[model samples]
Target: MATRCCIAGGGPAGLVLGYLLARSGVPVVVLEKHDDFLRDFRGDTIHPSTLQVLEDVGLLDRFLRLPHQEIGELTADVFGEVVVMADFRHLPAPRPFLVLVPQWDFLDFIADEARKFPHFELRMGARVTRVLEEDGRVAGVEVSQRGDTQEIRAGLVVAADGRHTTVRTSAGLPTTDYGAPIDVLWFHLPRTPEDPSRTGGTMRPGSMLVTLNRDTYWQCAYVIPKGSLEALRARGLPAFRRSVAEISGFLGDVVDRIASWDDVKLLSVQVSRMPRWWRDGLLCIGDAAHAMSPIGGVGINLAIQDAVAAANLLAAPLREGRLLPAHLEAVQRRREWPTRVTQRMQIALQDALLSPLLARTDVPAGVPLPVRLLQRLPLLRRLPARAIGMGVRPERVRLPPAG
Candidate 1:
């Protein structure tokens, strides 16, 4: 198979890029290893900026029609006192809130939309195993579907395969760790009508539990130090449930539902980025290029931003058959600054707050000074809300639908 762009890993990055380029009348193929898009990806926060991207692409209305919970304000339980931290109500955005939808649903929506474009093809169960290269530049990929392995040649091969991206590794692109000191234990707790109406975090003396309102349940995350999953599991299931219940006692009744350790999933959080996102015919985007910490649930949004940016910058060149290595480098140059700034913020949040806070076993005090201020001064809350809801240098749709 051959095309203008062959994308590996049909996650947010690949799907969005494929849709944009194909909509612009460029031949594009996205290879997704899984036959289905059903999986529990922890980060599901879609910010208002991403909604704007959808609006630009004529998808926001239809997307909003889907079932999703809106988080207009983020409230954190600090020292057992619940305080509103960031409020999106006043943000200058198309939608002034975060949408909590399963990642699979969001991906499927885009996939369905992309299928309408004549030049776009999404191959589920096609796992890219190798990067095809010519003269030291990426030319395409080797994708295995069912029992057949096929060579796909393209003008460009995008490695959106994710943090453990095979294409980037096969291409031997070097990455630098920005340092991460935590991981998360994810599980779910049944929700009742009596529980709080909004989604937020529970900060304990030495532990942190973040929850997303999944409508009928709370998708919970318990943050702990890096490489501590084994020790946590060794503590025994009963003990682990007790610890989770103790930390997030609000879900006391549902704690028993976590019956065994198998109910919990561990995500080894990573905060790092490739020094450069592209080389020759290959360009890495999303988690493949920059893995984000689950700090503010911003990773997915950042990945979507990268897709929009890449599409905006590369669609015309890809369509015109004038693609160059410089075009790939331009994507890195455009996105690197925002990636750096976001990672710095995550690192600072971890070191100054989470790391020290998670190491404790007793209650500290009221909310953090900054959060307390946001609670007291409701108007001032828009600052952090703007930061989280809009992000840095949000991208707009540049390619109109192919007519």
Candidate 2:
């Protein structure tokens, strides 16, 4: 197959780029390994930065119609008290809120929108095994899908495959590790009218349980030490539920829903970024370029921001058949700083806050004095809201919206 651009692993980055490039009348094919977007435990929060991108492309009105939960402020419970950690309500943007919609729905909406453009093709279940290189430049991808193997040829190839990306790793791209001391065990719990009014959860000794309102149910993430999944599983589901209940009594009733260890999904957190996101004909975007810590839930928005920046910088070049290594380099240069700044904040939060608390043996009555100041002072919350909600450098739609 021949295309102007062939994108590997269709997550937020690939889909957004494919949609944007196709709107410029550039041929694009986005290859997703999954047969469907029903994969669970993915980043579901769409920040205001991403919401503005949709608005710029004129898709916000239609996209907002999808069922989602909106959070104007982020709160964290310390001991027994609720603290307002960050506020998005004061953000200087059209959508000053974070929408918690199922990731599958968002991806499907982007894919379906992309398909409406004549030049876009989304190949579901198409697993990219390796990048096609010719004379030290990326030619395209080698894909295996449903027992069939084929090669896709393109002027430029994008790797939006995510953290465990095959395209970048297959090409031997080096990543600088920032190190993460925590991993998350994610699971779902039943939501009831009798539950606490607060949406967030608590961090007590040895455990941190975060309950996000996913509309139908509570999507929970229990944080644990790095490389502790085996020891945790050995302790069994009952102990896991006990730790959850110990953190927040509202979850005591629904701990029974965790029938087995299989019900708990483990997310090994890593914070890292590539020194160089592009080489020759190929470029890396989203989690493939930078694996973010799950602290602020900013990974999805960051990935989407990368997509918009890349499309804005390279769409004309791809459409005009003048795509070059310089174009790819420009994208990496444009996005690397924001990725660095965000990852730094996440790592600092983990090291300075979560690590100290998790290492303790006794439960504290309240959080540290610095955190208390953050909660008590209304001005302090906007700092994080700007960083997390709008990000360091938010991109506008430089190209025309797809019809």
Candidate 3:
């Protein structure tokens, strides 16, 4: 009999897993709660590492054709002094930069690709409320569609849910919260000539602008305190616009372009890691397993990497027999080291950007002059590209061969 895998939460991770598994001839089902792909303000940036994985999976061409933007460099402004942190042009790949595509479109595209495989099934509006266990092994999931509940029996259950993962909690796994004190206030602004290049723009001082198109708009994020969204909304449109203008000097024109309160959206940020990503016959991937702060801009990329790693490792064992704890253990071990390093880096970056004074104060005044000089060198721009390009290598991670 063929292996039956049920994937919970049809986000990028779940959808990609379904696509790869179905292509390898496994029967796969993806359940998503949302009735349609209409979410806004999701992470739209796809790092170079993720792009490489998409190319390997044969979806790069399609991904490129979607309405999107390319990011070339990341810049920082410290007390009115400009510094270039990472430049994508220096990376070795043909396409070294990050791509900014709306998450809804990307998810829809992946779902469409998964549909081409006869073994793949995507059921939107189907929400998995609980995992089904038989004899201490994950047998499947109990899901609800509209008002009706049904049971899906499968050999393996993969959870690709986001930070507040229901599956992770259901399995009784412990999650460690490494909270960052900042949150993100997201909003859209109309395109302006003063904005960075439409295709490969760099973030301007005091604001991060992701240009969507020459004529359409750009997405921006402003760092704020956690739980500040409601207070910000209560401040009303004028105050909100003023706050934006204060943070981003260039926002004078863009604030006027906003025209209405409906254009802005806010997201509270938090970073967390699951102590145990797997239990019994089930496996957790993506933000469900390791939630990272958005400061490093690697959340989506990491999630995609997790999907690739999990599929590569578990596909074969799942094909031959029931999914085992050993297989899940291997997945966690392969991902934990990279995940921890990246999370720590994220905290450091957050400190530098959001609390520069605190970061600077922490450094010794008597630090070596040569080290400070090296930090100011312009050649350091390649660092971001190098970091973004480093994703999980299937060979190193010990993934299974293609089915």
Cα lDDT of all candidates, in order? Answer: 0.88, 0.89, 0.73
| lDDT tens digits by residue: candidate 1, 1-403 | 7899999999888998999999899899999999999988557788998899899988999999989989899988887788888989887778999999988999999999999999999999999999988988888999889999999999999999899999999999999998788999999889999887768888887788888888799999989889988887788888888877887777888899997877899899989899888889999999999999988788888998998889988888899899998889989998999999989998999999988987877665556778778878898888778778988888888777767
Query: Candidate 2 residues 1-403, lDDT tens each?
Result: 8999999978888899899999878889999998999989999999999999998888998999999888998888887678888889999888899999999999999999988989999999999999988998889889999999999999998999999999999888999998999999999999888776555657777678888997668999999999989988788778878888888888899899999988889999999999999988999999999999988889998999999999999988898899889999999889998888888889999998889877888877667797799977989999988998999989998997544
lDDT of 3 at 78: 36
Q: What is the lDDT of residue 349 in candidate 1?
A: 91
Candidate 1 lDDT trough over 10 residues, lowest sum? 360-369
Per-residue accuracy of model 3 over 212-239 as CA lDDT, tens digit each? 4424675776666566667767888888
Name the top lDDT candidate.
2
Root-mean-square deviation of Cα positions for candidate 3 versus the true structure, in angstroms: 4.1
User: What TM-score would every model get versus the actual structure?
Assistant: 0.98, 0.98, 0.86
- How does residue 190 of candidate 1 score in lDDT? 94
Pitting candidate 1 against candidate 3, the one with the higher lDDT is: 1
Worst 10 residues of 2 by lDDT: 196-205
User: Distance (Å) between predicted and true CA of 58, model 1?
Assistant: 0.9
